[model samples]
Each structure stands twice: as structure tokens, then as C-alpha cells.
Target: MCKILFINNCQLYFIIYISLPTLEKDNEIIDIDPFTVFGLFNKSSMKEINRKSIIKYIADEFNINAKIPTSFNSIPVLNNQNATFYNFIGYRNDSDIDDLWELFSSALDYSKNPTQANRDKVSKFFDRVINQKGNGNSKITMGLYWISPDTFLNLDSRNTWYIYEAGKIPDNIVSILPKVEEKISANKYFDIMKKISEYLKSSASNLKNFKELSFEAWRYSEEINHKEKSKKVQSQRDDKGSGLADEDVDTIHYWIYTPGEGARKWDEFYEKGIMGIGWEKIGDLNQYSTKEEMKKAMKEKINPNGSFMNDALATWQFVYEMKKGDIIFVKKGRTQIIGRGVVVSDYYFDTTLDSEFPNLRNVKWTHKGEWEHPGQAITKTLTDITPFTNYVEKLEALFSEDNDGEIFKEQEIEYPIYDRNKFLEEVYMDEEDYDTLLELVRNKKNVILQGPPGVGKTYAAKRLAYSMMGVKDQTRIMMVQFHQSYSYEDFIEGFRPSITDGGFEIKKGSFYNFCKKAADDIENEYFFIIDEINRGNISKIFGELFMLIENDKRGNSLQLLYSNEKFFVPKNIYIIGMMNTADRSLAFIDYALRRRFAFFEIKPGFKSKGFSIYTKQLNNKKLNSLIECVERLNNVIADDETLGEGFLIGHSYFCNIDEVNDKVLSNIVEYELIPLIKEYWFDEPSKVKEWADYLRSAIK
Candidate 1:
């Protein structure tokens, strides 16, 4: 007899649930009869049928006609009698059966008897399969022969074998499979397909390999389709305004995407959610209300006393025409009461004064059976009343009894103040004896500092600031280099649109800030140092300020459009500019800037005390040798328009200790001096070669 037991926590719920009526001895077990617990009954009782025969019967019912091997071999048993007799007949271990099933399933040939065309077709099928599946969130299910815990794991290994054996799968498909699997596990449906597609299109070889067909299966997954469903929600919203009724006003809140600095303002508006217009966008005057309730709320919150009664009365009339949530501007010079109190309230009549109450002055209040004298009520003003009604009537007109039409408007405006005296006195230099120099600058002070290379035309600008202002701090001096891209906006104020919640708001530029800073500090001298002043789009950079740079127009005030900011260059602010004549490609300095700033030719001053001390340390023989070579080259370059006096080697050359070495000297000859000579003396290579050879010899 064969017995089956169902055990939960070592406690048998049922013993001998089902038994096959067979052998005589109850102790002699023919099979473990694992399925006896299932209690599957057949009407036909076959006393001689083995476990393999029973399995074959079940397989036939399932339409699986594959052959089954006997006697617990590695091959699976298809026939019921054989499976029961050999594998499940007596005391069979479930673990052994599971392992056998896995081995059999893995060994099954999926590509058996496949023709060349069939192989190509499979490859093509998987190509599309991988592409579509890889690009989307989809799952491909391959039927497994078993249902053990390792079924999927076994299936995965089989699938990998099929993909690798196919060999025709694109590299991209193969590469993207692992990533797709990872994405699937993470449940990132949308990004999975996107990432897969990106990998397929990318130059990476892993994605190009089609060996891994799993990516193709994942691309077609249903989850990916769901992820792509709501991609255009925002676009749809933009296409159709808020779905509020035609009669009803819809408040559509939108965020302005400003590129760079505007991002901050856009975020602010998004967070604040349409709290009137951004202050940076508009001027001081602002309005708030879209509906009547909001307006009434504003009136209650803002307006209290019924003063300047006529304007308040007019506002009330305006409110009647306003729709719910409709914003309207309150004209200037409205009733003081409406202005003082942001809202309007109930209306009442006073009968104390009877002299034709249409004028507010004639209106009065009746108190305790006694008439109070009235000209303008203490609570109200004469201006508060209108010609059409008394103070009470005017107050009623201004005050909205019901909260109906309300509007909210933000005024975008900014007032930038520039201090004139403070800027000049602080930024400019002024001492008792040098007061005359400041005066000279006010009238005519044309000063220039000339020096050799490294002698520092650039360095002295800072020193000049110190000499003029007696302040060693370099921050007090403003330094700007002239470049072709440098514009007036960089040197002066210009309208630059900034992104605000409402829209683009124009703001001031750098020059405006600098001038504002200078304007605030006028007690000392301010030095504006322009390095490489000639190499710029001078007219474009200066704009109209080119004319204002003159002495006469120094104090003339100017206003910028975006901001109500007034600016003026003070007389005390001295303009010191440096120009390197060696840069032949640069255009001539702007005549306007030239007139404002003193032109100083900073040539190689070899005779200067600084240069003398710099050269005195050099060996006499080397100094003389260097001088002889420079003189010879100077003569050769004297007539060349491109190679002028600036090309001459300056005394600073001898000051550098490294330049004395033979290798460095040869490099100077080969790299710097030779190239320069070649560019300038193209037709005279012999002369160039001679000069180079002489310099090389002198250095050696």
C-alpha cells in the first residue's frame, strides 16, 4: 500500500489521504504516491497501471505528447505509468523530482531541426522583439515545463542560451538587456524604455550587441505604455485655458521660465502663487482683485474712513461694472476715504444739515433729536462727496455692499537713486596741494605713464589710485579691459529682461551698479582704469555715455528707462586708461574716450631709473651683446609698419635671470624672436635668420 501525508508543523492533518489499491502487503510500498493528497480520482480503475502510465495519462490530457524515459533516468517520463512506476512509484523524494525537471527543461532543444530560413526568421523575430520590447515596458513570457521555485531562474538561463546561440541579435540589444532587467526590477517603467532606446541609439558597443534578447521583450511591456500616457498633460493645459465657464473668470497661474538670473524670480512667483505682479517687473502702483469678493475684501482691509469722498464714490461706481475677480485700476486722486481704507462699506443718509445736501459740505448727521451743524463731517471731507450725491450717497457709491468684483494687480517699478556729490568726493582724489591737480582734471589734466614691458602700465593704475585717494585698497579703483564684445551695458546701465512670475522684467546692468556705488561715495577720488583701452568696440561700449564723459557734461544727469534711476559722472572721478601699442590688430582708441581720458604712450622706457636698475645687475659683456643685437634688429624693423618701436626688445629682457641661460635663450631665439621676425620680415628670411643667429650667439 502507498500512503500520502499532509504535514503542517510536523502535525499530520491527514494520513493515507489517497491510496492506490495494489500489492497485498501493506508494508511493501509500491510508490510514495505524492499526488495522493490531491485526491485526483479516475473512474477507470487500472490495478496494473504504473506511476509512469498515470503521468503519461495526465500529459496526454494536457496535450503534451513528448516521450518520457523510464526507471528514474535523467530524461523526463511522459507516460503516466512509467513516471509513477520509476520516479513517483515508491518513496520518491520531491527534491529529486524538482532537480530532474530543471535538468530536463534546460536540456530541451528550442532550436531543434531549425532551417537556415527558420534561423533567419528567428533572428529577425527577435530583432523586432528586442527593439520593441527594449524600447518599452513589456514582459515576454516563455512557457516553462515545471513550476518549482527556481522555474523563472531556470527560464532566464534558457532564454540567455537561446539569445547567445542565435548570434544574429544586434549588439545594442545584447548590451541593453541587463540594464532593462535592472529597470524592470526597480519598477521604473518609463525610464526603462527610454534608457533602452538611448542605449540602442548610443555609440556604446554593449548596446549595439543583440545577443541579449531580454531587452527586446522589456521594450514592449505594458508598463512602458502606461508611463507614456500622460506626457502631454501640461501641453494640453496650455492648449485649453482653465475650463471655467465663459461667464466665470478663470485664474490661470503660469510660471515664467527665465534663463539664468530670472530662474530665481520665477521660482519665487511659483511659490507665492500670483501675489499681485512682481515688484521687480513693475513700478509702485499696484492693484489686486479678480472678483468682487476680493475687491470688497480689499476695500474692507484697505479702506476705512470715507474721506476724499468723490473718488471713493467713483470707485464704487467702477466696482458695479467689475465682474467677479476682475481687476481694475483705481485712478489717481480718488476719494481719500477709499484711499485711506482699502475697502468700502454700507451707505447711510444724515439729515442734520438741510442746505441742499447734494454737496457733501451741506450734509450733516442727526444725533439724539439734535441736528449737528455740517460743513464737512468730521468723519468725512468735502472732497469726499460728489456733485451727484451727499457724503452718504458718495460713500455708498464707493463702498460695495456685496463682495462681487475684485481684482489684484501688481505694479512693477523700481526707483534707483544715484548720489552725485557723495560719488565724486569719495571716489576722486583731493589733497591740499593736489587740489590743483583735481582742478586740472576738472579743466584739463592729460597725464600719461610710459614704460617698457613688465614695467607695468597696468600696475600703476592701482598706485595712481593710492597716490590720488591716499587709500591703498585696490577695490576703490574700477578696472575694465576693452574687448570687442564689451558693450555699453557692461560700462553703463542698460535694459536687461529678467524672468519674473508674471513675465519678463527688465533690470539694470553692471555699469548702473558701479555708478550707483560711486555716487554713494563722493568724498574721495574714484579711479576708472581701462586696460587695453584701445581694443574694444568703443562706440558700442560707450553708447551715448561717450559724449557724457566730457568735462562739461560730467555733472549732467541722465536717466535709465527700465529703472527710474538718475546717474551722473562726477568731476572728481578721474579716468586713467592704458594702451598696449604692441597689439597691432586693435583699432584706434575712440576719439570720444580719448578726449575724456588722457592718452599715455607706455613705450619701452629703457632710460628710466627703474630700467637702469633692472639692467645694472646684468654682466656688462652680456648687456653690451644684447644691446648690439637689439640695435641691429631695430634697424631692420624700423621701416616695417607692422613691426614698429614696440617690437624692439625692452630693457626688461635683461632683468629676467632665466633669460640668461643658453637653452632658454635658444628657445627665445627659436620660438619667440624667430616667429616674430618671420611674421614681420617674411620677405627677408636671410635678415631674420642673421638676427636670430646673432641673438643665439650673444646668449651663448
Candidate 2:
């Protein structure tokens, strides 16, 4: 058994030395500082000491009076508190006491525990004390012990005890015990219980309950003050009006009250006549003087159901510019009232007041929903009047009964316009040839400018039409290319229906619609140009319109499929077709369609004046050399089986200035030209090779 005293902040334990034993030869009693025994100092400061020194220090201080182990069972006293407790049980040797004492002494020297576990335990214990005090009005003392007894053989000796400052112990000792327990005796149990109780009572007296009344009182005061302030703000608003009333005064006040409250107040105000005059009190609002007099005077000016009449009482007074149709309410002498209605028939006013009222003897009165004057004409002025009075007078004179009436006389009038000959001289084109083509366009529906490659065949058609029409806008012309897959169904209307309401609907195509638009625009001419006309399946693409392509059949209506929508090739629309002779695979253009279009060949002309200007711009020696080489090569290949006259190099060959470098020109000749020739003469690679060699030589 060991004697232990557990105080409020510290635990004291003493080992019992029941029997003395001889130590080993090397074991000697050593002296250790008290601070070292508490394990509070650093290891370096206690490096000169050992565990033996610590045990010797404690043993020397207490001498042999230190409590000894015995067969007696006694309860441990934990600092004057009355509570049940137990001792820490563990293994112990004589050497163990020396180790504990040395740890304690070194800790005391450093003013802190040497080990982390001991330091944390001490901190947590103090935290629990502070927290407990913070939460409630209670004080507590906790005790812990590191006990090692000689009888213990293992390491489960650490324990703690909690003691309340209350209660006492029983004294029936020997009688209450079992038979085996009666053999042992313990006399210190009652003393230990008394000490624990005394400690608790002393701790309880120092505690006080926490106060919270100040915070509670503050919250209650703030809530009452907020409610009182809100009531004051609402009361202020009730004394002032929001300005929405319907009185005749210049400054009237309107207020909104709680639903029932407003209605009650309204009834009170009405009884006191505070609401003033309403529209209903004004008199005899529907009397007018005469039928024609009202028509000429006031009939045109009244707007009875207008905004002003809708809320009549909302108007303050009738002081404004007076007009017909104005409902005037005037205050007459003491108890009488009078009302008059203005009747201005036209927008103008005569300003003459008529006192004699027209007779109502011939007029019959009829009852309708509202009051209205009978036999009165409603007068209104014509809107959007033009200032062309002279033009109107002249038109009336031309169709008058005194003269032979004619809306339009076919009288020839001369106007100074651009003379064709002078305009052509300024623009530098042949006037007779231009006018001939222009006349053909005005009379004909279809024309084709068939030419060899690169002769401005398409350009001539466009320029001639533009010059004749004196039109500078490029947007008026519609140009398209004809190919093998181009069809009448795409050009004209087809059964191209859309799924609408679970059924299909046919839609019109572009050509049919464009022609319809052209027919409607009778003053302007429309040009439809087709490039590469020979490459398309012409007869198939034209369909029944092949006959209508002629000038005589134009403007004749033709019915299409799916609907009775008639399509006419408008006379204003001229079709110009451009064909390239290089397209060898193209089928022969139909003879019937060919007769409709006049063919004009456009060939490469090196001697033309335009070609001379084109060549002069190329002043580069290499380009001139290239042209000369191509001309010589063309002479040789002209008689070849796979090459012909149309395949010869045109003046357009020297026009491309993009590839100014020799390397780029070589690539253009090898890649672009050779491939085109190879396609045309696939079975004759020798002739293709010769042509490429000539082109490559021109580049060098």
C-alpha cells in the first residue's frame, strides 16, 4: 500500500519501504535538486545527475519516516474532500523511484515539464478548470497521480480522482466487511474522507454565479423603442395628403386610407359638400341651335367621348382656346346655372355669336342611346392635300365639255437628251453598231455572243446594254452560268412542295418569279446573261419555252404545271448567252434555239489596238520574250492533230502580271497550262509534252 495526498492543483504520493534490502555494488545514494525531481528542467542542465541521485535526495529528505508498505488496506486521502477514490496500481522496483524523482527534479529546474505528454496534461487540466468556471457557478478540484508500488509488477499505475466537497463515511467497518476482508485492517479511511470533504467546502465558498440581467434588459428596451418610433412615422403621414383628388380647385389633396376607412370618410365628406361640384350637377348639355347653322358653326368641333369629357370634373376651369364641339359649363347668377355647346363645322371659326335659335318645327326628334342633332352634316377636311392646284386645273380643262376631251393627246414633244453619235464619240465606241445591237435588244428576247476564248464576248453584251439604257448601276444585271445539270425545274416552277399541316405545298422557282417581277416593272429593262450556254443541255433546260425564246413569241403567256400561274417572258428582259469554243465535250446547241440568238464570234486578235496597249504595259523583257516564243510555238502546233487554232496563245496570256518572278512563272506553266492541255489531249501526251516545252522555253 502507498499513501497518496491529492490536493486541488497537485498530487503527492509516497512509496512504502516495508523491508530494507542491500543494493548492488555500483548502486549508490546520490543527491539531486528539488527542481530536477519535478521534471521541470532541460536535460542539459541536469546532465551531471542520474536517477540514483534523485531517489537518494527524496529518501534523505523524508528519512525512514516515509510511509512504508504493509498488509493493511486503507482509503487514500485526496486533500480534504469526501469522495470515493482508488490508488494507481503498477509495477515498481527500487530503481523506478529514483527515475521518477530525477524526472521531477529536472522539470522543476526548467520551470516547465521536460516531456510533451506531461506538459499537455497539465495544460488541459487548467483549461477544464477555467471552462467549468465560465459555464456555471461551480468550483472544482481534480487530482492525478503517477503511482508505482513495490507490489505492482506492470505499467498500469497512473490514475485520477474527482472529489465533491460533501458527504461522510460509514463506521461499521469490521461487521460490514466480507469474511476474507475482515482479516485486514485500515484506520486512515475516515481521516481521508474528512480531509476531502473539508477541501470541497472551502472551494465552494469562493465561487459566485454568473450575471446575465444586463444583456436581457438591453434587448427588451430596444424592441419597445423600435415599435414606438414606427408608430410616430405612420401618424405623421396621416395628417398630410398625397395629392390625387378630383376637385375643381387648383390645389387639391388626395389621400389613401384603409379600404373601409376611406369609404366611410368619403360618405362623411359628401354630406358636408366638401367634395365640391361633380360633372352631374351641370345642366342641359345637349341643345344646339340649327341644322345648317350647327353644320357651318359647331358640328365639326365636338369630340363628345374624348378624354376631356370622360372625366369632366377633373378639369379645373374652362379658360382655354374655344373651339366647336367643346362642352362649356358656366356658373350663372345666384342659384342658376347655364351650359352651352360650340358647333364649329369646319376647322375655322367665324367668331360671331348668334342669339336667334333655329326653328325645330320641321325636324323630327328620334330617341337614340345618346343625344345627337338630326339633319346635321358631319364636316371634316380632306387629309394629305397636295399643292398641285395648277396641274389639277389643267387636267380638268383638258377633259372639259367645251373642247374635244382627251386624257392624253399624242402630241410629239422634243427634249434635249444625249445624242447617240456624240455620246459614242466621247465613249469611243461605234455608234451605229451599238444602236443596232440596242434595237435588237429592244425587239428581241434572246441573243447569244458566240466567240472563241478570251475575246470580251460577255463584256460587249454588258457594255452595249448599259450604254443604251444610260444606266451606271451594276446591280441591275443578273448573270448565271449554264451547266449540264441545270434544269427547267430549277429555272421555272416545279412541284417542290413543303410539309404544311401534314400536307405538301408546291412553291415557285426563281426564273418564273423573276419574269413575273419583270412584267410588272414595265418602265425598266432587265438583262439575264448566261455564260457557257453551249455546255448545258439547252433543250432540256429550256423545255416548252424553246419556241418562246424567239422575239415574236415573247410576252406571250404560257401555263405551267401544278397551278394556273401563267409565265411570260417579258419583252423588257433580254437574254445574252456567252459560249466558249474550248469546251469540246459540249453537245451541239440546238438549231431551233440557235436561230433565236444571233451568234457573233469573238477570237484572239493580237493586232487589235487594245492588245497594243496591254503589251506596252508589260514592258518587261522576259514577258516580250515569252510572247514571241509562244507565237512561234503556236505556228508549229497549229497543224498538229491534237492542237488547233483555238488552242493558240491569246493576248490574255501576257495580261497576267501576278507571276512577275521567273520561278513563279515556271510553276504556272508546268502546273496550270500542262494540266489543261493534258486533259484536252489525253491520248496524245507527245503533243502535250511539246506544248509544255514551248511554254517552258518562253519563261526562260
Candidate 3:
């Protein structure tokens, strides 16, 4: 016997041996059941899939006297035709059927006789299998194994990987078996299967078929992949605390869930404070280790028509993807929102509940009364609508009246007193410059604050609005970031999936809704702030609003493309946009937009009285030394011909630290500052290294 270690770190090995002595020579009785291995692989950790019944159904379809089909898809695996699963298992070919009936009859003959001539003739179809969809193995090979699991082994990639290269590759296999990569001839395949049968018989008097073992091999490969995926989503869970506040709410998944048809289970779920999904016959969703596995079971037992894709996805998300504190918007049909809540418990399978809907999760339903939906919710049973902020906001609006504070407690917007002095003190900007910014917005209806990153551009923009109003009113402010994908449809108004009828409808955009809100309160000021304003196609995003956003065009109406409604930029709406000058990729502002708005430059405030006073209060000697180094570095950046004052480091990087410890300072140098330095002087590696060393030494 020889043991070969394929992966040293994992301690994985594949053993090769000539043969093993029979169990009769040993002291103990042994059991060689592939089904046992298969069960252990999936059933021990999760719910067991009914593999036997499905195998029985498939085997029954290939009986010797079974009628031949016109096309391979005419053969039903779990009563579904043209399923991609058949292609994956290498059972169905998309093409290459010259005479379907004759080929079927020949395959049956080869399975029964197992003669070299029959094998030679039938194996010809192996390469002819269209694209060799999965495993790249002969479909005939898989079929024969299904027909006689004990006498034949599929030898697909899944089976071979488990045996030769996968984690702790199976031990004590007979010699002369095919290599892992070799596509065995029929005789070679028979010899390998016979060896497997012999190895099993040696352990016990009773023998089981290799069908269960084949399933086990597939499970082994599947489990490894599932574990890797589990690791990636671990951060998505807030295992400690109630998943509330900024500490725990790093990422929140917003979901829309429906209680059975017409929300028949709404009362039961609301009363019980539990949400549930059906497909009980497939057993606990936990049994299926992955969504693909759950989807397979759904195809087999529940939705055989293969419409189960979306339902299975929703089921999998409910069981695994969803974490506590994720919002769940509940609705009955298309146009009505029935309730809103936060998921408060991990998923559970309750057999006592309606069997059709056994999978459940506990929910703290904040509101239960009906409210007219602004648009038609998706037709799916469960959907993750986190990406659609407009849709999520509109749905959240319906619950504002009945909101019991459970969901919005953390989001309770604060209207802290903010004015000219407060802004100057915090933003590190002098009163004169701050007043200039305020006047720019007052005169030009639209003003963009452009500066290097971390210059307090966004910060100062917000405070400028508050000072202009003489009070910080979050209700009068709206903020969004512009990306390469931001469009007029997203920024203003365009057709989205209809909320009332599941078709396209003119769903109002954020700016349009904010404008309406501001229009109603004409006496108060409303600020619409766009961060990273130059990242998007300004002309495309502003669309027809370019003219309306002009100081003179306020309240001048224009027909919208989709709704054709006479929409106008409300006079009370003040547009405050921020752009990063250091971003080399930003294009010049749209010429049309440039004419309508005033542009203000914001330099770093490191030398200002406010920043000096603030840093002196901290009294960190190392921080002051670091600031001196940054000031020196900023001089070189400003003097560089390719770069300018826009590329200078901003004071905000040093602003937010409550504790000025060496570790935090070092992190800012190594992780944050060094990366930016490298990009700033990308061609000058020595310059990057010198400054990098200079910055790191100050922290030390």
C-alpha cells in the first residue's frame, strides 16, 4: 500500500493498494453500504433527501422492456422533461440522437449483457453528447450505474474526485482501478465497478448497490463548496445583541415576504409573531445543505415544473441568508401592504404548523393594519429589495403612521442645533470661507462643493444647509451618492416595476418626492445633496432638470418623459452637490449644468484655527507630528505639475478618532494613507515609499 498526500496544509491524502483481505479473516463484522455513507454525508448535518425513491423512479424508467422515447428528454427524471439536472448528471444529451429508439434499445442491451462488443458499440455516443454539459462523462455511463448500482459505478468527476483527490480520499480501494482523470473504456469501467463490489463483499456477507455511494460522492464535493460559501456570509450575521444600532447594523438585508395565498396565514402568523413558507414534503430546509440541493429537492417533490427556481431561492434565503434585524415587508396581493416587521429569530422548521408551510422565522411585526401600497410589490413569495432604495422607501412610508418604534428606533433622525459657529467649529473652516459657501448656495440655486477627499466636503455641505436654515432639520434634507450607473430614471422619475399591477409604472424618484415634500412647505428651505456628484453622467442623470435647476428656472414646469406630468424644480429646493477633485476619472461637469450652478472650491482645513484648536485639545504629541508631516507632504502634492491642491490630504482623515493610539495611527498609515499615496505617485515608487516610511515613523 502507498499513501500520497495531494494537499499538505489540509492533510488530504489518496491511498493506493493492491488488494484487501476479506472480513472473514478479520475479528469484526463489517458493513459495506454506500447508502450508509450517503446518509452520513448529508443526513447527519441536514435533513435527508429522499434519494432512494428518486433512484427507484429513474431505474424503473430504464428497465429492459421499457419503451423507447423519441428524444432523451421524453424520459422523465422526477417527472420533469427537458430539465437541466438531466444534463448535469450526464443523462440527457441536447443533440446527437441519430435513431433515438435504436440507441435506447442498444443501451438496454449493453446494460443487460455487459459484453465487450455491446460496450464498444454503445460507448460511441460518449463524445457525441452535446457539449458534455456536466462531469463531461458519458451519459451512458451514468445510466448504467443507475440501472445497476452494485454492478456499475458512474465514475463521473464527482465520484472520481471524492475517491482520488478530495478531502481524505476514500481508503482501501483495490488496485488496477482507472486513474482520476482517465475516461475509462466500458471494460475498464466494469473492472473498476467489480473491484468496488469485491471491496464491499469482503467487509460483510450482505452487499448493497453502489448507487448510494455515488450519491455520497456527490454530497462530499457539495459539502466542501457549501462550507466555503458559509464562511463568506458569516459577517452578515450579528450573533451578539439584538442586531440594533450602528454597532450591529453593518449590513441590513431588506426583504418582502408574503404569507400564503391571499395572506390566509397572516392572522396566525401575526398572532404567533412567526413568518413561514411551504414545501413541507421536502422536509426541513436545513436538511438540504445548499440552495442548489434545496432546489433539487424542490424539483423532485414540490415544483416539478421547474418553476421552483425563485421559490427555492426565497426558501433558501429565509433559512440561511436572512439574519436577525433584517426588515420584512408583508403584503397580501399586489397593491396592499398588510404589515411591516423586523426578523427577531433564526429560522426553524415546525412540523406542527400547516405542513405545507413548515419553515418559519420569528418576527416582531411592528404594524399590522392595511395600507394602500404606492406601487405593485413583486409577485415573488419572498424578495430581497434592498437594492431598490426608492421601492423600499415608498413601502416604508406606508407604515409611518402605525410604526410602533421597533424598526425605526435606531433611525430616529436627530435635528441637532447647527448654525454658522457650530459649522465653523466642527468643519475646521474659517467664518469668511463658510459665509462664502453659504452665499454661493443662496445666489445660485445649485452649488457643488468640489475638493479633495476627506476635506469635509460632504460634512461642510450638510452644515452649510443647516446654517442657511438656522436649524438642523433632517426632514428638509435628502442625500444620495452618484455612481456610473445613476440615471435620470433613478434620480428624478421613470418607469419602474408597477406596484399596483406588476407592470411598468411611473414610480416617483427620490428628488421628485423630496421636491413635492418641499413644495408643500414653501416657507422652509429644502436641500438636495449629491455626494461624488461627478461620478455619474451629469447630463444623463439631470436630464431635463438641467434647465429647471437654474436659479431663474425655479418653479418653471416641464413635462416628464414617462409620466408626462408638469414637473418643476421647487423653489424651496436648494441643490448642494459634492465632487472629489482628486478622483482622476471624473469628467468635466456637464456644460449645460455648469451654466445653471455655482462651483465652490474647498481646500484642506489643516492650517485653519478650528483644526489647530481641535487638535491641541487632544494633546497627542505623535498626532501633531503626523499633521506636520502631512502638511509638508501636501506642499509637495500642490507643487507637483501633474497634481494640484486638489490632491492634497484632507483634515477629515484626522478628525474622527476618539482615541489617538499608536495602533489606530499605524492602521491609518498602513491601510489608508499608504494606498492613497501609492495611487497619487503611482509612477514614483521611491517617492511613495519615502512618504510611506515618513508617515509610519510619525505613528511609531
- Pick the lDDT winner: 3
- Model 2 compared with the native: what TM-score? 0.36
15-115: candidate 3 lDDT, tens digit per residue:
11112112111312122212112211112222233333323333353453544232221111211122111222134443433322233455668768968
On lDDT, the stronger of 1 and 3 is 3
The model with the greatest TM-score is: 3
The per-prediction tally of clashing pairs is 112, 38, 7
Estimated TM-score for each candidate: 0.35, 0.36, 0.49
Candidate 3 Cα RMSD (Å): 18.9
lDDT of 1 by residue, 536-586 (tens): 787787666665667678779777544566667766566666666555575
Predict model 1's lDDT versus the native: 0.39
Give the Å shift of residue 442 in candidate 2: 5.6
Off by over 4 Å in 1: 1-455, 497-507, 561-564, 587-589, 618-624, 639-643, 652-660
User: Once superposed on the true structure, which residue ranges of model 2 sit more than 4 Å away at CA?
Assistant: 1-444, 452-465, 499-503, 632-648, 653-659
Q: What is the lDDT of residue 69 in candidate 3?
A: 30
